[model samples]
Target: MRRITLWLMSTVAAVVLLFSYRTSTMGATAPDTPGVVGAAPGVVPGGPAPGPSAGSSAPPGSTVVNGTVSQTRWGPVQVRVTISGGRITDVVALQVPSGNRRDREINSNAVPALRDAVLRAQSADFDSVSGATVTSDGYRRSLQAALDAAHFGS
Candidate 1:
């Protein structure tokens, strides 16, 4: 019985040590190079790329949109907005860890206000969502981020 228990313990210890070493090694290596294992056959890594024409009209449409919103104890609120062609096409709740309770309220009250605001202002400076101040602020910030990216590249 003693011999069996000792053998089992030794095996478990060895396995744990091996797993730890493997995990450490895994963290040490760099991730796969950009154009190596799964890269396209002909494309070379770090190759020079073509430049856009000076006359290009801002790609003619929306290319991509992303946003992040953080939640607070006051409410589950965050904002993400997507725009194309100098217009807001979509708005998302980026950081609302909480359910849509307050979010819904904000959306209901703030969306129309926001749409009006967007239409009126040169940029995405919408009013806060009614009853959901934090969410409203987050949404506005997100919209601003998207609009800023659209207008200024930064």
Candidate 2:
């Protein structure tokens, strides 16, 4: 009985110590390469953009248009489209549900997939991530807006 108590206490202490060390070291290490992985879209080591260009206009040949900021339960979803020769050459996620870890993870995965899909389809008539329906819906909605603004199809 005494040995059992000792083992339990030791295990608890070890767990506490592990957590303590993790919490202490988490913020100590700085980002090796800023503006890379885990960096917010259009963000650098300095800071985020001054503000979101919610509904910016497009240029003549190459257009840069921001889509609607579709606000979901988690957060807002938006996209920026780059068009060249009336084709979607690039799609950048200007905003996504990033209030929590789950939101970040989901967007990190879903945004890239959506970008590729949209680029391939050449329109917003693409599928969303199966698990992340809300974010996907927002993506589609905003993508459509940007496409409309760019006058891609019409």
Candidate 3:
């Protein structure tokens, strides 16, 4: 009886502590990236902004396609691909989570690696960056969409 009562009390206390815990991001507002304006469709308000206008010139024999915006837990992620000679020549991340210092720091390291991986693989089948799984997943989703739209690697 004593052991059971103690266990029950500990469980109740654990539940209370768990419910009372608060995360730093619980009520935080994610800041937008500079020079980014107008949220894409289905993107969270104040989230990823549009990239260069459609009228922007592309290199000869190269087509630029913007992938569908992917909403991540932290913010939105979007990729733009420049395809030429039936291959992805350039991969640009138009949007990434810049909501906080941590997000910026993480992406600063993760995005470049992610871009390089896609260029080498010629697809979005690369592994996710450690400690930035959410952003990596979002990046892959957007990149795949862009590749599909461009009919790249088909």
lDDT of each structure? Answer: 0.44, 0.68, 0.76
Poorest 10 consecutive residues by lDDT, candidate 1 = 36-45
Task: Compare the candidates by lDDT and give the number of the best one.
Answer: 3
Pairs clashing within candidate 2: none
Model 1's TM-score against the true structure: 0.42
lDDT of 3 by residue, 1-154 (tens): 9999999999999999999886655422343755444534322121232455434556676777778878888888888777777777878787888767788899999999999999899899999999999999999999988877767767
Judge candidate 3 against the unseen true structure and give its global Cα lDDT, from 0 to 1. 0.76
Best first by lDDT, ranked: 3, 2, 1
Locate the minimum summed-lDDT window of 10 residues in model 3. 41-50
How would you encode candidate 2's per-residue C-alpha lDDT over 27-85 as one tens digit per residue?
21232222322322221111222234334434455666667777665666777777878
lDDT at 70, model 2: 71
TM-score of each: 0.42, 0.61, 0.71
**What is the C-alpha lDDT profile of model 1 across 55-117, one tens digit per residue?**
322233443333333235333333334455655544443333233344444456665665566
Question: Which residue runs of candidate 1 sit more than 4 Å off their true CA positions?
Answer: 1-60, 75-80, 94-97, 100-116, 119-122, 152-154
- Native-structure RMSD, model 1: 13.3
Off by over 4 Å in 3: 1-31, 39-56
